[model samples]
Target: MENKDKTDWRFKVANREALIGCGLALLNFVWWFGFAYGMGSRPVEEYSYILGMPDWFFYSCVVGFLLITALVIFVVKVFFKEVPFEEEEELR
Candidate 1:
């Protein structure tokens, strides 16, 4: 194929993967910062300990969110290679 077509395909694939990564990161951020914290009125200290753990257990949530997002992004980049529109016909 032409060199321009090859370049365009590479560009499109890169953009598609980047978009996916950004979306996942945003979702993680919202879940951890918005849903978890927004609903809570008082400080974590006001709550009783759970199973000997402190009420301010939100640090774990932050770390877990980061780890999960990293794994998801890695999996998306490794297993999901995007195809250009022109190549769709070849799949048939």
Candidate 2:
């Protein structure tokens, strides 16, 4: 036998938002891991120094950081929706 409640789970918008956020988070993690690992594996002598750090560190840690920062800002501004979660009323 199946049981149902007044709140139909299928109509929830939060699930979709959560899924998109989790997907983006996973993508960001992969991006960081791949670049940082690729850069870290190279010999120290092969990379030129930037700000007293290896070129790989400079690009992977510093520049990649800036790119991700911009990406987050853009996504938050353009893609993220302002939705009232169902819990707002319950908390009061």
State the displacement of the C-alpha of residue 20, model 2, in Å, after optimal TM-score superposition.
2.6
Residue by residue across 1-92, what tens digits does model 2's lDDT show? 54456464534555776776787777767767776688778786676788998777777778778877887788778866676546534333
**Position 63, candidate 1: lDDT:** 56
Question: Residue 34: error of model 1 in Å?
Answer: 2.3
How high is the CA lDDT of each candidate model? 0.63, 0.71
- Best prediction by TM-score: 2
- Report lDDT (Cα) of residue 25, candidate 1: 74
TM-scores of all candidate predictions against the true structure: 0.51, 0.65
Model 1's alpha-carbon lDDT is 0.63
Give the per-residue Cα lDDT of candidate 1 at 52: 70
After superposition, the stretches of candidate 1 with alpha carbons farther than 4 Å from their true spots are 1-7, 43-48, 51-79, 82-92
